[model samples]
Target chain A: MSSKTANPVMRSAAWRISLWATLAFACGTMVVFAFLHRFVASDIRQRTDAWLTGEVEVLGDVAEHTPKDALYDRVVSEVAELASNEVPNRLRSEGHSNDLVFFLQTDAQGALTLWVGAGRGEAYLDAIRRRPFKPDEPQDLPVAGSDAPYRVVALHIDDGSIIYLGLSEHDELRVLRNLRFRFFTWWLLLVMLGFVIVFYTTRRMLSHVREITEAASRIGHTELDKRVPVSARNDEVAHLARTLNHMLDRIENSVRQLHTMTDALAHDLRSPLTAIRGKLEMSLSAAAHGEQAEPIVAAIDELDRLTEFLNTSLDVAEGKADALRLSKSELDLEELLRGMADLYEPSMHEKNLRVRLTARGPVRMLADAALMHRMISNLFDNELKHLPAGCTVEFVLETAQEQAKLTVQDDGPGFSQEILPHLFERRVKGKQSSGHGLGLAFVDAVVRAHGGSVAASNRKDGGARLELVMPRGLAAENAEPRPVIIAIAGSGKP
Target chain B: MRLLLVEDELEIQTLLRNSLQEAGYEVDVAGDARHAEQLAMESAHDILIVDLGLPDRDGISLILSLREMGVSAPVLILSARRSVDDRVKGLEQGGDDYLTKPFAMAELLARLRNLLKRNTPATGEPTRLHVQDLELDLLRREATRSGQTLQLTPQEFVLLEYLCRNAGRVVTRSMILDKVWGMRIQPDTNVVDVHIYRLRGKVDGKGQPPLIRTLRGVGYVLKDR
Candidate 1:
């Protein structure tokens, strides 16, 4: 895609929606995982404490049954060793087998009297002595030599000597770590899958919207009959498309009604005008060179003027309403200007006015050739009617930034100050002018209808200047050219 | 000359019929397409003037039926529909010329005459055209008057040639614009008059009898006298 083209991913609502949904899902899953981890860790610690408490109570009972003699130590030590063996060897190697559990016996004075397993439990002795032991209760002890803490439980006998047992928390930590690792991996996969599903689903739904937009944009004024495509699915986009189609139907109907009304108006009005004009011409011919001929001629001219006014008024109104029917074709402005100048030279000469045409090259554009010709002619007619004798009218044609600019300037008395504001409006003319004042209005309408602009201003040096800028590219190339019928010389009867 | 006029409006029909008769043509009138088709099938006409807005059927359909029946007379369409598309449509569908309504009788007559003249086949292309002392060498694209070569621009020469071809007959401003300049729309200005004025100055210089005469509110006619 071009850099100037709109980036659909960034602009589409789908992108934002999917991103936010995935974030919310991830956060929700993380909270659930945290709660689950805490629950499992506490449950594992409770099981370990139960096993430590039962083992410590059994050791205290074995000591209470033994006599206070040398054999007592041996018997108690052996029983402790037997009980330690039931801890379930969690280490993978034999070298650290005994390191997982330690046993210690202390007197009523808190002096360590007996110790078994893992180097006499020297590293954990001070930690165990620092806390007062509650009978059959397990407590966590941070041993000096191990990163994992120990869970220690104590038991009291009738002689007041305490029996203590400690179990390493390394195995518990390993189980929790394994559970967390598995959950995190699964969580990551699910979040990615969720993001993909949401993004694609939303994008798929909105693609129809994009298609509708494109189809709607393609419909132009001339092709009012065309409509945006409506999809079959009963969804919001489909509803929107149907509504647009209905609107188009109403618009096309109204335009057709306008055309029918205007056509009828033309027929109704022009019929009587034709009759009156024809009758006057007949009478003028019958009374040729007589006293009655002059007024008949004058009446005929006035009728013709009235007809001109009617035509211009209708055209101006249609143009203003953006309803003017246009048959567009490629035209060269330079060539058209030159032809018009040659045609008008004699009349300008009669008024002792000079016309100069300046052009860089052929400025080609797509427009209604007939309308453009009449528009330019109206400009020349304005100059002819309003310019004083000996004033020069200059016409300049040039292409600027893909626009065809045509300027008509005359070194004459500029427009009257009062009418300057409303120059292009209908029926706004100079006091000395003798026109129906629809010329400039028609010009403005034509320019606007063609998607162009027109401006009127007085030059700083004292002259009237009219500038028209028409876009060179109009996408009406599909408009068909009217067929020309050449009269065959010998086809009809002589 | 014989002419057939088909118009729906009674007033226009009567006015056109009277004017055409006064212009020295044997005129037949019809108020609708059905009557026009009947009249056209009955007798041969030298020319036909048809109005598009008829009562029973469109005038275009009538013209088509007439042509299909081998009625080879030239047709001139007269209608109140003044759009360029309407004019082109009329001509494309068997019309020799198209004239909008509220038209001048002079313009109608000139068009009729031109159509009639066009129907007759010429023997061959002429190398030169002459009217009184003015001569146009077509091959060389040159014009001379009274043994003096006229310095005329290319456009002026073409305009003069169109006028000379219809010498002694009136040709309107629109006709000149169509034939010489090939412009389909008539400008609302006196461009033709000015061009003719300049052409007259060149053709009939100082101390020369003028051959062109202007019929006010109508057109110009170059006299052969």
Candidate 2:
């Protein structure tokens, strides 16, 4: 699961989508809550404004018709009645009970004559006196030591007297605060839900894309017959799998055709070549000695060369068809090369070429022993065929990190610049080369099939150098041996 | 020695018959697997040379059937299917040896002679091998020439033994590599020549007739001449 989430694309996509979705959801919730907050708040303020205005009008009537004493009595009785009725309601609900509407009367002067609410009105009266009030608009009186403000209203009649009415908006403010708190809580929940939904959906969709990527990574020549598994759903990913499967089918068909044609050519061409060579050889043996038999022997030699050329062509074709079957084993590198050097010692001496093998000790590697021998032998063959007399051929073996490296070098005319780049390619032979050019190419194929690599270049000082590097171990360790047997022409047994 | 040769191609059959006859062996030819089986069953031929490709059946099955019929003569299978698996399969089915198509006649004759030598009676046969004054004791794994014991490495001993067995006949480098070294692929180098040169130095010595003579580009022949 960690590996799945570690994919950079999927991780970033999931995070980006979740973050944007949560932000968008939070913004939308804020907008809706802000609108509701304003609507509820305004309605509460309007009701309080209407009730305060009516109290001021009733006080105005008392101040005009009665004397100052009667107005005072009316104000006092009204304050007491409101306090008694508000007590029960405040006790009934645990809300703001600071709704004590205050009434005050002034006798021909803008002075404080009455006070109400929780605190004394001396400070309230001073705040009201200091501020100017418009006759048509209600005034907001700030209570000195509280966080809530009050709505103040005033009324006057023809009695040369003034009346002021004040209503504390603490209850309405508390109601609006509660509404905001509820809205914020719900908005937080919605944002969390948005994040989860977005992340999950994005991750699920991208996982399907990863399946296609993994399938593509496994496609190669050896696995041309394999196809990406398709899901049952008729989705984009399934369609891609189907398309890739169709492509694989086409590739496998072509590979099969190439293999069949190669086998046929091996049979059709080699059989007749065999017959011709046999007859020529018989004639050479039966012919009279000296000049007459020379031509027959020469013809037979040419036929042998032709047969070798055909076999090389078949090897190249087989390489292309992926038919080079390998039987792997744990082989001692020192012994294998020693055998090769021993095999080539005679030819090396014929050219007066000094062959030196430099190896520390036995280097064991998991490889196909026969193929490895042939690969090295082909290299030596190249050295013998191209290098001049008195030149030296060196075989160096060592362990570098986890790989076994073998370098074959010869102090000879290095590869021409024209053929250096295409050295390992089939038929990429040098001008002095008499071979069919499949020697090095076959070597390259054998090395690659063993999961190793081969390279050719010119040495700095002089000489052509070819290097073969193979891993020292296999992924399956020294797993069970395959039952496939490789029968060489005269090899007795393993 | 009488030989039975089975081949579908007329030219190859005719050529092999003439070559074997000239080599001083009586040869009988068969154009197909059926005729070859009939001849092999009726006559006591010293050797059988059968081709894998036949009109009636595969030569491998033919050889297998011959063995099943209690014909114990050494069989050499010839075929165009030179893949290791095919050759191994042919040998696994009771073939004494296998030679691929487009082979050298000399190599074929040498292999046939080797097979025939093995099939001959071993009674009264000395445990030692000799080519003129040179002698190799098979039981003791030692070699001596002119009453002087020569120090020989294991590889050199094997090479000398092969040359002694095929004395007076040419043995190609490939044939020696195959039989002595047990190698199927021939190296581009003249490894056989090098070993033979080493053996000649020890065996021929000073004031000795050269026992092993190079046959130019063909091979080496060991003879007291």
Per-residue CA lDDT of model 2 for A117-234, tens digit only, reads 5567677777777888765357788978767787888776576556677766666777777778887797778788878888888777666667776777566555666778788889
Candidate 1 residue pairs in backbone clash:
none
Candidate 2 residues B1-225, lDDT tens each? 999999888877877887789788899889887898788877888888988889899887887788788778897888776354544554745438888887777798987986887787657867899778888998889999888898887677888888888888888777886777655565544556777887788878889888888764457888944
Worst 10 residues of 1 chain A by lDDT: A485-494
Best by DockQ: 1
Each model's DockQ? 0.61, 0.40
lDDT of candidate 1 vs native? 0.81
Which numbered prediction scores highest in TM-score against the true structure? Answer: 1
- lDDT per residue (tens digit) for residues A90-134 in model 1: 445445646777888888887887887777555677988777878
**Residue B108 lDDT in candidate 1:** 90
Per-model lDDT: 0.81, 0.73
Query: Candidate 2: what lDDT?
Result: 0.73
